[model samples]
Target: MKASATIAVARCGERDVVIDQRCSAPFSVRQCDGRILLASSAAAPVGGDELELTVDVGAGALVSVGSVAASMVWPGVGGESSSMTTTCAVGDAAHLDLSLEPTISLARSRHRTTTLVRLGSDATCRVLEETVLGRRDEVSGRLDLSLRVERDGRPILHHDERFGPDVPGAWSSVSVGAGRHVVSAVLVGIDPGPPEVCVEADRSAAWLPVAADAAVAMAVGPDRPSTMNMLAALHPALVRTAPVSKPRA
Candidate 1:
């Protein structure tokens, strides 16, 4: 089955957040503490499914989006594949946070995902993407992931990666080393930072400046907990510590 979900949010006042419009099936959106939570419903997606999502953050609004649970990718019975695409727009002085859950690819399964973000000159945004190869002692199927962000119509960040059986040594390559999972995080409109690498207990993570005001972090680990710990260690450096304030009148 194929599925799609869309969500739009805007600031009503100094601290009021509102949902402009939403459309979804097999996925549901809930609002809590000015953040939007997405979850799969009874008609959750399975093999051969396609999902799409669009998010719009109005001027002066502050919004965060996250999933309730990890999405499981199962192999198609007849050799089909699944795909997901997301598009986001952030207005002037707005803030958008995308803290998506991990994607677990089962044996022989195939999945693809793409995300595009457009931001205003003064907008602030943070994004996270994670993928786990497979269950215990199993090799993952395949995955193609891409993310792009542009501000004022100029490209600010672009990342694309492919992993799976089709790619030679996809799992055991130098890139992954001893890690079975990978996580990436990006921060825009932040202060510049020097490139550096940090290692902890069989995990390796790196942070590099992508633009004058943007940076990207990548980590690889043997399992979810370690990889996530690496991500947590790098978050404070990329994300702003101060709260988002309303745009000036």
Candidate 2:
């Protein structure tokens, strides 16, 4: 029962879009101004859920992170198991896009996510992640995931995934989020220019911020496809939500 939240968002957009933020939580955290809205799905809380978050972006402020639902990680029916943690800080010519979506671990869940970024040497960032696996829909059990990413403090990227089935690489096809279900990654900010940014960094779905900076980990299973490219799997608050998704109902 260690719930937590700390947010500091200030860009107040004209084009810099941070929208708005100011939150402190013990429980009861539903946000506005772009989003952060998830109050729990299956609804049951006596003393087994934990959420910790800390976000700060000020120096050239620009932040966009939206999520209010699609956070389902439940699995502790008297055997006890529940957890969550997130951290972020961005300054220096600041611009941050943290839209970490898709997290579902029904059944018997245990989740962990840790991220740290401190770049003052021309600071700029783009961090997007995704994870989905819990039996396409017809619930089962077992889910464990851990992730960490850091820069300037070094720890480029770290990983873990265990959706069960003896969990030893959980069915390795040569690494990371193996046997897939749907796992994604993207990390940017690095453009020292020259030679068309190293030939557009060999064209691995270009998410051009300055030049070409990349970190792409892929997993999809069944012949393991998804070499990630749709403009380097574009993330920057998903290009501002693709122009408001004006499709039909």
Candidate 3:
């Protein structure tokens, strides 16, 4: 199956959120106040599924986006692979909160994902990405993930990761370790606080300052619940309570 989804939000006179434009196929989008929820209406992604998504935040707009449930990538059939690409643009002083559900890669599956974000000078953003290697007692398939972020036309972050079969020594890499689940969060245009690290029974989490206005948090856990707990503990340190106001030109 192939699908595409798009959403654009603009700020009205004062605090109203205007959905300038929206389109979706196979994937459904619902708007509530300033928050948007996405759900898949079509069958779960299989071997050769493809998906595309785009989001735009108009100047001064505040919006949050989330998914209803986790996505599962089943093994490819007939050597077909799956892929997804997403792009986002945040206008000046706009605030975007993207809390995506986890993705599980089943055995023998092959999938690729890419994300690109462009932010205005004063824009603020919070993004989360999580992945689970495989189901109980099963080895994961293959996955290639890439993320890029730009601020005022200049690059701020560029990251790429590959996991699963075919990548030599990938399973034992220090970055991923032997954990079953991994979660990463990025915060932009937010004040940085002191760095903190926490270790629990089945998870390890850390909040690191990337820059004065940027921060990143990551967690690796034996299971989904433990990983989510770690993420919750680190969220307050990375997420800003209020959006930053745009400055006069």
What are the models' TM-scores?
0.89, 0.32, 0.88
Q: Model 3, which residues run further than 4 Å from truth?
A: 199-202, 238-249
Which has the greatest TM-score?
1
Question: For candidate 3, lDDT tens digit of each residue in 30-146?
Answer: 764346777887655678989887988889887777788888888766857898788999999888887778888889989888888899979978877888989898888898888
* Whole-structure CA lDDT of model 1: 0.77
Ten-residue segment with the worst summed lDDT in candidate 1?
240-249
Q: The CA-based lDDT of model 3 is what?
A: 0.77
Pairwise lDDT winner, candidates 1 and 2: 1
> Could you tell me the lDDT of residue 67 within candidate 3?
80
Cα lDDT listed for each candidate: 0.77, 0.49, 0.77
lDDT tens digits by residue: candidate 2, 1-249: 666656565544433443344444443445455454434434432226766766776666656554655566666657466666667777676656666546665555555545555544355666565655564643324555566555456555566555655565554443333333454454555442322111122122322332255454433432212423333344433233422211110
Locate the minimum summed-lDDT window of 10 residues in model 3: 240-249
Cα RMSD (angstroms) for every candidate in the order listed = 3.2, 14.8, 4.0
